[model samples]
Target: MNIFNRFIVTALLVLFTSKAFATSPIITKIERINVNTILVTFDQGIKPVSHFDVPIEGEFSVKLYTSTTYYLGSPNSLIVRTPTAVNPNDNGFATQWQWEEPTLTATDNDGLSEITINLNAYHSDFENDIGHSSLDYINTLNLIWQHDLSITSINTLDTNEGTNLEHTLIASDTAATFSIIENTSGLFSLSGANNATLSFDGTNTDYESTTKSYTVKIKATTGNDTNENTEQTLTVNIKDVTDTAPVIRRFTISQGVNQGRLIIKTDTSVTVYAEASGGSSYTWSSSDFSVIGSGAFVTFIPNADVGTRTIKLKVTIGDYSSERVLKLKLVESHPTDWKDKNNNGINDSKEIGRHNNELLVGENKKITSPINTRLLLGIMSEDTAHLTLAQMKKYRTDNNLSDNTEDTLTTGDIYNYVVENFSATATTQVIIELTSPIPANAILRKYSPATGWANFVINDNNIQSKTSNTCTDDTHWQTGLTTGATCLKLTIKDGSENDTDGDQNNGKGQVNGVVESTISIAIPAASNSNNNNNSGGGCVYNPNAPARFDMGFILLMTLSAYYLIRRRRCFNH
Candidate 1:
């Protein structure tokens, strides 16, 4: 049992152990490219052998090779040998082999299987340090055999625009490395190594309009097939959301060249419109539903009354809506061709009747049709006999003017007198009245057909009780009005800096500022006040009168006293 026997046994044990743990060649391809062609692959090289002379039934010879020159490390440098039927060659290895078997057909072996080859030691670990000892070993290398390996796919995706595309639901083989072979839409992408995932980047640009579809060609590979690769198309369907709103560009009839203040004449019609970008429509209405109708160019007839009215419009596009309102007014027709403006079967009678007894020529013809209050008015005279009853009656009779001044002189009576005779000279009293309290700071003015508006003055005194809405100013012949100033006007004048210089007329200005009411002036039988301010026989101009300048008189008195003082000094000398 000596050292010699122990050495022999230990050497045999090491040899067998190295052969058992040697690396096996990897099987990469096992699928038939066609019915007659079989493809095979391995991680290492096969030793090549020549074709044999003897053919066994339907079988032909297999080729093999060994590659030993360029690899490194323990498993990196291992070698391969064929099944015992084929022999290994000297300096070559072959993963590509040609083998014909009587039992093999494309129909019978349709999926994954393997081929077994023997693996031998590194050239550095060669037995007896020889290069040809690989044929003696029984250690085998198993590779993917020539019977099937392939990949399938899911082939479709659905997503929304502006959404991230990470689709893990694409069904594919786990053994493959996935790639996008064609992506015309620039939406499909890939990531990861073995069995990659499909990614999509859907932006607004990715979808041109509302809904769209895209196609991408994807391929999965194991680096095993050499002749051709299989590719599939992935259909991407993009989705869109709907829009829901409408807009109205114009809501009121406040447009066009001839319109003023949203007000139209009786029996007149107007149109309204709205707009929307997303193919929208509109429906028209009124506060009084019977007045307006629906359309792009809907027309509305204003009510046959002088009052405010409201019109409404509703606009819609898809599921959205907007509404608008129009506030408008209606008024009576022109006086020459008057219509039943109030729709009450009355033609201009109520409007004309409000002014005392009858309408006056060239007066404000536009009136609200259904007035409830009495329109009171008056006329005063110049500083002479201008509006005397005889003269007024003659003018009225000559011009066909109405003499409805029976109870008291009506607005028509005084109006016609001045319209016929503006040069009749007189001086008189001023009359004014209202239903309620007058607006504060109102005054009376005279309108001369030759000049313009002027202040009315009472050189004698302001008479009458001065009630809330009524006042009477009695004038004297010498200190009141000019000979024949045509019209008289009463209006509110909230005293501005430009109204007057506070003299020549009842502490009032040269202008009335706002018109409240009016009539003509008739001479009143009154005498001048005894005050020195009006005793001189002069024209009492209400504004811009010479009597308003007292500064010149004071200057003249100062000059006269200086001259007298100098003459007295000379006389003393």
Candidate 2:
């Protein structure tokens, strides 16, 4: 326990601690190229130091320069040693060593000599080889190096270990090879990556009917390396052929009337027939037709007497049958009557029998009672004098009248009594039933062939006269006539020639006579009463005139006063 013993022990403990816990050589700069290659340079200089009382050189050695190599095992290792001997010419000299396994080897054993060696290590295409060769090694004595390393061995490793490597080579040719046997179903598919099923039939001749395309991939592995075998899909297009036959449906027949004519008064019944294919023979039946047959023809007759008639024609074709109906009609003929004798549906009798006796008789028959008598008188006068007695008798017979009736008169009687025996200066009277009131200006005209004269006289006075044979003053003849009142009269006057002397006769002559007869004028119910304003004499009466006075005298006095007043006013003004 003395101080000397303490000094000696402490010195020994310091020496032992220095040897046991030596300072590690710092890697000042370490550059790694890819995953496999690394370059290291030291910063501190080498100094001779003692360990365990032995002389040791300040040499640096790279003991564990670990990297990955494809041909080596896990964590493939590299060890580098540099000698401590200095070159005789330099005082502060550092050694630098570059190493590549199997390419270069170190000769100095002192671990301080400068050495360069090439290691056949794995290299990536992106690594710089020149930078890996120039690295400085300083006083790095026996540097126990530790580094993160990757191993890419030639032998196959587990999936977890090989997944970290950047490059792996696979035995692509020795791996499984897949070829498309057949794409039975025409669809796109991949092998290994995706399996597809095809629906194509191999036995069919149209093997390439549809294009069959597939991807073929090969897999190969050598130890831990893997290679991909890729191939573009091959498309096999199958060609098709025409082998089926064309099909057609059978032909069918339907019967109908092309054109038919039917009489309006007679019955028209027609039969429709039809025929079709797909049968050896056809049996025909119809509800209307009495006859039945086993041929292709079937007929259906319909009873069409009036209006339209339809008959259906049916034909059977194998198990199927079709039907068609035809339409026909029977129209009534045109009617025939007294007005439409031609029967062309038009009343042409009126145009054909214009002015005939039947037409005249029909018009004359329409007149009632007293008018009928007047019309018969007028017609009989024209016919009796111009026709013989037998002719007049025949005319009466045709009109459904007795020839010996009291109304019947002979032509000789009309000529001798009404025309000859009656004086040309004499006048006869005949009464007419009245249906309306007579108009003021109404006149009567009578024809007298015996005297070669016609007379027209006003019908106002009961006593007839042989006036002038003109109707100049009769413009208002239709005025003042009322319904249900006697309205018209006729006065037949003799001419200058007399049947007695056959020449002009004066006052004592048998000519210049008058035949007086009465006629009834019918006023239609729809006629207006104010239309009686028509005046015949062209004279207007003064409003101040007395109502009891004659209209003719008032009109004259008014005209005279108007003239005198106009003259006086002219003088005064």
Candidate 3:
């Protein structure tokens, strides 16, 4: 145990202890340069390695560099570049860099020796720093965490013209809310929980009349964070429905003039036009007769075929076509020839009928058909040369056959007549006189081939005074008719007339140039009231029927006024 031997042994022990336990690199601070980058500082200088790994839950790369250029607290620092940005809402993460003192082939400066750095090695003490040599150590690292919202699964979509479109909105956050921020077309809406559902508005779209496409901007937001919101634009396209059936509507152009019902006359041409929807082309044809032209419109002349014939129209679009058939008739035009079997100043054959027990004269005539049917007709024309009643048919809806003041009644009937060759410039007039007194509210309604029905207003301004006439104002006579005449006279302008068969006129099409007219009467109910028992049997025309003022109503109104006056007086007293 000498002094020299003890000193040497103590020195050796100290040297061995110093070599066995050595201080490792200590991480000091972490700073976030941007959302995708971070700066990491350590207590000691770390070797500049090409590649390394940090215990973090994302994809990133690290660069070891000198710290004096950036004045980061240590001589060794790391610059982390994360192409995938971090979620700001992740709070703080437990991340560290660890290495074992096993196999690192360190070479001299500018040496070509290969360096191996174990980056993914597992260690037990991850939560706490493991103090070791500078070449092998674990250092804790801190990063700024963030949240980012993203919109996904939204793209261009397509739907049929008349159908609705629906799509589920997808976002980075499950609790995110979606809203339509920009929609100029007003055809889209966001609904359902959190507004996560996008849908088309409930409106039927027409391919022919509506906009073809729509563009809208949608935004996704969460947690009341403006920075966490995202926006995207979506497009919706409308597809046409080619299989939709075509619809056909019928119309007629008469004499190359005004549009009206179909005209069927011998040697006179009329045009039939078919207006069809969803049709690219139209073919007008007929098996019974040859059509004059082709396509949407076709003109035809009856010639001598004076009966019903079928006209067919075929509409085609792409590979589909639809056919519709229409029935039309042709009638021969006749000239006016009324014979005077019994000689008189007036034309005898032109007489429609006579007044009760009297013969008509001058322009007045009587219709003497069907036995005991009395009708007086008056014609006022400068030249009645070519005028003729080309056709006349009676519909069994009405009847009025009785002498003066007879109580005979009948349901209303329609009288259709086709007047031919009348002077188109000079207006012709007809005066119809019935012997029996009609109901007070009776009206004469006229029918046109184009428009269905209208009231035939009587013209009293141009009424002609009759000599030796038995009609009177009391009998509902025209103003200048006979004062004591017991008949009702009506004067109206003629309307262009037409009456086709049932198959044609069943609300599909109508023939032009045939005048259809009817008289409607409101028969008085059987009542013992004094108004019904008036001197003329309620046959006067009353435009406004005033309300009756019975004795009870007058007394009640008087009492009500008296009560109001009494109440005012009491209040004043």
Return the top candidate by TM-score. 3
Cα deviation of 110, candidate 2, in Å: 99
Query: TM-score-based ranking, best first?
Result: 3, 1, 2
Q: Model 3 lDDT vs. the true structure?
A: 0.44
TM-score of each: 0.22, 0.15, 0.27
Query: In candidate 2, what are the lDDT values of residues 150-201, reduced to their tens digit?
Result: 2221322112211111223222233333334444444323333222221222
Q: In lDDT terms, which candidate is top?
A: 3
Local error of candidate 2 at residue 538 (angstroms) = 9.6
Compute the lDDT of residue 127 as modeled in candidate 1: 19
Q: List ranges where model 1 is wrong by over 4 Å.
A: 1-244, 251-263, 289-294, 333-573
Per-candidate count of clashing residue pairs (backbone under 3 Å): 32, 45, 24
lDDT of 3 by residue, 163-266 (tens): 88898989878878889889998888988998988998625777777678788899998867776798989888888887544544333444443233323465
Give one digit per residue, the lDDT tens place, for model 1 in 1-573: 799999999999998887766654444543433434444444455542322442222121232222321111132333332222123344545454344332234223533233333233222122112122132222222223333334444667777766767765332345556677788878778876554677777765345575488788877665666423456787888765333334333332322332322345545566654433333566777755255556555676665455445566666666766454443445453334434322221234434443321222333321110122111111222111123345444434544556633321111222211111001111122233322222222333443322223444433333222332212233322222223322222222322211221232443322211112222332221222222464666554333224555898889999999999999999999
Evaluated at residue 376, the lDDT of candidate 1 is 15
TM for candidate 1 is: 0.22
Candidate 2: list runs displaced more than 4 Å. 1-362, 365-437, 445-484, 487-504, 507-573
